[model samples]
Target chain A: MDLLSDLFLAKAAFIGIVFAITLGIAAYSTYFERKIAAFMQDRIGPDRAGPFGILQPLADAVKMFMKEDFIPANSNKWLFIAGPCLSMLTALMTSAVVPFGDTVTIGGVTFDLQGIDVNIGILWVFGIVSLGVYGILIGGWASNNKYSLLGAIRAASQNISYELAMGLAIIAILLFTGSLSTKAIVEGQQNGHWNIFYQPLGFIIFLICAFAECNRTPFDLPECETELIGGYHTEYSSMKLGFYLFAEYINMFISGAVMATLYFGGYDYPGIDFVTAQFGNNIAVFVGMGALIGKALLFVFVFMWVRWTLPRFRYDQLMGLGWAGLIPLSMYNVVVTAFGILIGKPFTAGIVGVVLLILGLLIHDQLFVKKKIA
Target chain B: MVISNIWYFLSGLTLLSALMVVLAKNPIHSVLYLVFTFFCISGHYVLLNAQFLMAVNIIVYAGAIMVLFLFVIMMFDLKKNQPESKSSLTKLAGSVVAGTLLVLLIALLRKNNLPAPSEVNFKSQTGMVETLGKILYTEYLLPFELISILFFVAMVGAVMLGKREAGERNF
Candidate 1:
């Protein structure tokens, strides 16, 4: 009972730490995204608030909070309020399953550097992310605006569409690790045996689906300003609009963490054994965690990079890419992964994936060429 | 004792939310209540230590299906077209049908005289993913495969119906 209680206390504390980390990273992501965009576009970014605008997010937060909490007269007040609350809640919940670092022992009491350890960690993330649709859907419907409704519908469809391919893509990881737990997946990838090398095709499909699921460009038609003015959050003002935007950033952060954990040998730095042998487990654990965070941040940079570089896909093109392209590719990956496991040659899976990818590119090229001729 | 208390609370919330689903005036409110009901049931599944079932239940019902329900309901102009109220006779007929279902359920339960799920001895691992997956793919492989094929067919049918023609927008 005492041990259990102590464990509970540790868990509660870790939850607080994880929440702080997720929110802090999400806050800084906004700053970094702008800085990255500015560099890409050859312009100076937000350098006003503090050194290189480190305090810009804080300023933005204050501005968001100080602004008038406006609601349209015709809007469904209750659901309008529920929308952002649900959005933020679901985005935050996905962080609970991520194993941040190895355990730390003090006074012979071990503390896990995770929010919660569950056997179904990845599935829990999946389920929570699927629920994220309700936030935008509710907010859009409640707004009583055409653009909001249209955006919400598009977002719901987009999320659901991409989820199919995403689940199938992750099947390759599950095949490789043979476990649904994120910790187990990470453990399987220890000493640089990452799933990415084996499941490159799966990773690419997952990356695209992740982009779509997060509603980031080139899949961000739901919120593209050129088409729909503010889209789903059109009628939202102040913190509510901030919640929608912040939720996107949070989703991006969480997805990046998930991708890192899934494919980038999470919490496993190169020469980890040497580090642990030299500096001790505590220092090594910190280094491992730092590496993991650095990796997640790298993926976040990729998200922003893609957002700035790629143009938004037309609605049909986006749907066509998801249903016609990624879904089939993912299913093929699943089949080849099954065969690779059966044959006891993991490299066979990578080879098959590459072969299939080449064939797909050729087919798409041929189709494009024929369309041009016609 | 605390566990039982949580189970009771969760089951109570599940029932309340399920009732609210039928009673809510707004279609969207009804859908949301249904989602809450699914969530509370997921809580019950967690209480029973069926983590996989809880996740799948929430994912399939509260997440995917309910979102589609919300999507369709959101598109409807609710203020313009109110549902027509049934007459007294129609209400009586509906109540009669519901009453018959209740009576049949009671009779079936009394006939079986089976113990409640809580009273039955069950293993902690019964609802685990490994056990479930093994049983699904091994013992129930054919049925599982058939059901998946059925779903695939449905998906294909949806795509066929929704497929865009030349010079036409699908959406």
Candidate 2:
């Protein structure tokens, strides 16, 4: 009974730890994004709140809380409430499947640093991400605004298009690792050789799709405020608006963590197990958790970096990237990877995949790329 | 049994939404209510562990189909108006027919003494999409092919219905 209670306590603590970290990181990422953008543009951003704007997110939270919560007169009150709730719920739920670290044995008990290490973790993550469309769509439709409706349509189509590439990219990784669990995927990359080396094309495709799916620029067409006037969240105010904004940041962080877990070495640095052998499993797990978090944060920084570096994509350009660029690249990536696996020549397979990708691109350009020479 | 509880809840939602689709005085409200009915039916699909079907149902029916409905409703410039009142005799007769149908259904249920369906182990090892594809392509292939033909015929019928005749005139 004591053992069971201890086990439960550890599990609860693990969840609590992640919840606090993710929520905190998500809140701060908003501030960090602004700061990064400011630095890029050579202007100070949000430094008035505290030392270098560290407390800016806190101040923003206070403002959001104190603001008057208003519901539109014409809206269906029930579904309007359900919209943001569902959005936030689905966004946070994806983290449950992400494995943050290996097992840490403390005192005599070992606990995994994941909420639930289910076998179908990858599918669960994808499924939950797909559900996020409802939040944007329902929120926009409930607003009864033309811009919001257009934004929702853009978001839905964007998700559908990019999801195909994302799924295809994931198939390459699955083919190589032959595992769907995030933990297993990470472990599969343990031998100082990440799947990224074997499947560079898949990695690039997944990264681009990740950017689009999370609605970061240059793919943030849904909320292109200059064009669509706040897109899905135009009608939302106070906590509803907060939920939409917070969900975006949380999703960014979660997807970053997923990328780190799936493609990067995922805490299997040069000599992780060597240290584990000398010191112990607990210390190793602690270090591994820190390393994984570091990697995830690095990816998060990259997300913000890319956002500031790139201009917002035009609507047509965005769709063209998904269909014309990413889709065929992903398909060819899959076919080549499958052949490589069958033939047991990963190096040759990677080269062949790259060649096929370039060939596909050349064909696309020849066929669809309008002749500017004319 | 848990699923039965969910079924009860979702069925109530579907029925209520369907009723609202007809009873709503505003045409836009009726269209919105119809979307809600589609969502509830999608919930029923999810409860059945038909995850792929559930997503497709929502994406196709609620998202795409209802967006078209909303577009038409918006384009039509429907004014909000109260429903036309029915005469007491007409209301009474409608209720009588509905009540008779309810009674007939209850009588049939009682007379048939339908045995409780033995619970089958329906949990699938494969993903919902894979299982659905396997079934549709293998065991249900003929029916699936027939359905495609039926869909094609329906498409032709719709075009015929929607097409304007050259000789038609406004009186």
Candidate 3:
């Protein structure tokens, strides 16, 4: 009973910490993405508030809080409200399965650096992400605006298409790791060889799909302001709008973290166990966590950098990527990689599989994809 | 026990949305209400300790199937109020039939003895999903595959129904 109580309390505390960290990072990412964009454009961004605009996110929060909430006259009032709330909720909850660091032991107690450890952790993450589309669909439909509705339709199709490829690509990863738990995947990568080296093709597909799933540039048809005038959130204002924006940034952060954990070897530095042996477990766990955070932040930075670097793909091109390009590539990766795993040559056979995939793609593009398009 | 409050809240929301689905003025509103009803139903599925089903329900029903409904509704451009076609006598008769069926269902439910829910016996915390998948793919694999083929045929039929012959296309 005492141990159970302690676990309950610890879980509650962990939930609080995860919530605060995710919400805080999400709020700040908006500021950071903007500042990064500014730097790329050779202009100062949001420097008026506090030193180097460290406080700008706070100011923006205040502004968002104070803005007047509005609903269109024809809107379904309940659904209009529910849309952003659901979006924000699903985005925030997905981070619960991500293992941030190894366990830390203190005072004869050990704490896992994750919100919840489920056997189906990867599935939980993917499942939660698939729900994020509801935000777009509901927001668009509830807005009762043509542009918003169109944006929602585009988003739903885009997300569903990319998600198939994404799931297939991850299945390829799972074939190698032979486990679906995020933590286990990280452990599998701890031998100084990340899955990205083994299954670079799958990693690239996953990375592309992750970007699309988050509705980032080149796949952000849901909120293409240039064309759709703010898309699904056009009818929203005040905190409702804040929720939409917050959910996007948080989704970006979660996807970035997932990518790092899945493909970039997570918090495993080259000789992390050696370091822990030299020092203590707690200190090593803390350092590993820092390394993980650093890696996650690097992916986050890349997300923003790509946003600035790449132009949005046309809707047709985006669909083509999802359907024609990604789906087949991912499926082939799955079949070959699964066979490799079964044959007891995951690393070596993965290389051959990757080579075959490249050759197949080259032949397909030259003969099939191009011919079909023409 | 405290977390149960959230579950209760979601359940209430789901029930309310279902009620609204029946009460809505327009077909479009009905469809929107139906989507919300799915959302709430998924919440209940979550509460029932089936996380996989919760996600699958949302994906298959709310995300994919409901979008098809929305698309069709949008294309049709339905009015706020459907035109009443049946007479008062017919409507009265229909109501009587519905009410009688409801009473019969209630009576049947009240009279029938239900088995008590089995105590939690599964070793895995994710009991429902694991068990369901085990039963579905193994013991019921042939039937499941058959049903899937049936669904494929139905989908093809739907496409055929939607398409016009080349000779009629110009017209």
Total backbone collisions for each predicted model: 0, 0, 0
Candidates arranged by lDDT, highest first? 1, 3, 2
| Positional deviation of residue A284's Cα in model 2 after best superposition, in angstroms | 2.1
Tens-digit lDDT track of model 2 for A16-117:
999899999999999999999999999999898989989999999999988889888987676678778878887888888788788877778888889987
User: Cα deviation in Å at residue A166, candidate 3?
Assistant: 1.6
| Residue range with the least summed lDDT across 10 consecutive positions in model 3 chain A | A365-374
Native-to-model Cα distance after best TM-score fit, residue A271 in candidate 3, in Å = 2.3
For candidate 2, the docking band is incorrect
Positional deviation of residue B95's Cα in model 2 after best superposition, in angstroms: 7.1
Question: Model 1: residues >4 Å from true position, as ranges?
Answer: A1-4, A363-368, A371-374, B103-112, B116-121, B164-171
Judging by DockQ, tell me the better candidate of 1 and 3.
Answer: 1
Give candidate 2's TM-score: 0.76
Q: What local lDDT score does residue A207 receive in model 3, on the 0 to 100 scale?
A: 90
- Residue A204 local lDDT, model 3: 88
- Give a tens-digit lDDT track for model 3, residues B33-63: 8987987887777666776677678767876
Give lDDT tens digits, candidate 1, residues B1-171. 477887888888888988899888899999999999998988888877889999999989988999989987887889887799889999999999999999999999999999667755768888889999999999999999999999999989997897678999645
Per-residue lDDT value at A173 in model 2? 91
| Candidate-wise lDDT, in order | 0.90, 0.82, 0.82
lDDT of 2: 0.82
